[model samples]
Target: MSKTKNSFNHFAWEYFEGLEKTQKGNTLIRKKGRLELICSYIGNEPISEIGSPRMLEVLLDIQANSLNKAGKPTDKAERCAGIASDVFIYAGARGFCSSNPAALIKSQLAKSSYGHRPAITHPKDFAKLLRAIETIVGDPNTINSLRLLALLFVRNGDLRRMRWADVELATGRWQLKPLKGQGKVNMVKDQVVPLPDQAVAILHKQQKINGHTEYVFFSQTAKKHQIISENTANKRLKDLGYQNIHCAHGFRATAKTLLQEQLKYPLVLVEMALGHTTKDPNGTAYGRFEYIDDRSDMMQKWADYLDALREGRDTTEFRADAQNKADSTAQLKALIDQLGEDKVLELLKNKD
Candidate 1:
């Protein structure tokens, strides 16, 4: 069909080209895929002709047939509706459409049933899970990926797509623009992860297999320099009897919970290590390098804690500090427990 430039299909492609100027990686790919879905239904129609009713019909059709990664129905419909709304907004800005139909119809889509990514948060339960992960026999890349996921707890996509150039083994830091934050507003543009000794050791093991390749986790069957599959670790976890109980991404929650409740690291440090953007009272976002030394110390301590957990030892008294001054710091812990970590830190700074 000969479609006009004002056709929904043509305008969507134009908007995607604009997105390409800023978005990249999976973020761009996902947006394009969602737009393609919309085009599949009404590509040849003029933008002004596709109203809220028509957009709702297309989205409802998608909701009826599509399933999300979790095999749930309707989540993909909501996502497509959102992406379609973005396209309409782009067109409206350029005078192609008067209003955003997709935006108006989002509420009519079927409600999705997805919940938080399942994770084993209890320390003892998590430790048992970690020990079980140790016995998983499979591709070295998948195995090492699981190991490092536990150690670093970065997003599953960030870990899988890690590049050699972004890693500095000598400096013990892995720096990159996180996939989730890329091309999005109010999201951190850069993330810097301090590599613990255990993580470095695991990377050294991976280096033997993929050091020559561009990606740290290299895949033979994939396109050149592509990393392993995103589900590789999760599939192994399922086989190891952790289905629905924990997943590769769940390592973040596992670490976040245990680091605060078990190991007693401050929440700010944990959140920073997890690559989350937090604004202070002045609405200033903290930089990636704001607390590098403290984060480095926290990373090492977390690795040590995991080792202790894997070995099935008492981790209640674990500290993220290098010095074994637990006995001397008993009063400090009591103070923190009494006044909270933030208040305790402020008190110490004031005293100093």
Candidate 2:
């Protein structure tokens, strides 16, 4: 190892390499963008020379200077601080720094509530959006991709990077590779998403068009056989008059809300279906595959529920089904409490 301290830019490159080793598919692209911003602000200075104050200045500069595609001011201080904090921690671990100063002043960074992504949480509004997606005149690939995002509720990056090889139509499962920031550190396992019948049907149609290539949403215009751009789906949504109301990422939030609040699935099941990490009561993170069966069932029901909403069918039946299951569970618990587990099991077996 060189005794000379590494520059911030050098450290960032190494850190990004570390991210690439662990993360998959478009995960580190955002981090690399943030690193570019940091490097632009600080130049190629020695990592040890910049402490917490300088880190704070860099973050504030990013916040005040960043602009969105719409040419409006956007705040990225929180994101910048997060990246710097991680970089400093990596440097500290490698003996190039004494402490992660970015962590110390992270809380003091600028906080803004200006750029919240819009989502349709209401069932009726979501139904209208689904109708719009179905009827929209655009690239067929873009439309189908948008529908898949709404139905499956995976991250936009995950959807864009989907591979046909990862999809098992017969088994109704899509084996998702870990995106840049998903799952625990150093535990990069493929996430198995249980595809609903509707989602699988969409995939079958997509296969007819793009089956020759690896990506499900492959775009001929894009470089290196990559799928469509990240903004393609959202741009379509905006063109459909959902600007600031619903974007591609909004689909995930929309699904998360409706599944729990409307369909009454357990929070854990919903989170698992979305491939998010949730901790148990002891503060330990749940295993990635802890609730596969329940998640599968929940995803199928969610797809069915979306279909009902799209057709403007009465959704009360979904709520009724959920209530019936809850009631059955409660009654079973009561019976077990009264008659004992063995007696209850015997009674159940007799009834069977």
Best by TM-score: 1
lDDT by residue (tens digit), candidate 1, 248-305? 8899999999888877788888888888887787988899999899999889888888
lDDT of each: 0.86, 0.80
TM-score for each predicted model, relative to the true structure: 0.83, 0.77
lDDT (tens digit, per residue) of candidate 2 on 9-68: 777777888888876444467778888877787647888888878887777777667766
Enumerate residue pairs that collide in model 1. none
Ten contiguous residues minimizing lDDT sum, candidate 2 = 180-189
Clashes in candidate 1: how many?
0
- For model 2, what is the alpha-carbon lDDT of residue 198? 87
Q: How far is candidate 2 from the true structure (C-alpha RMSD, Å)?
A: 7.3
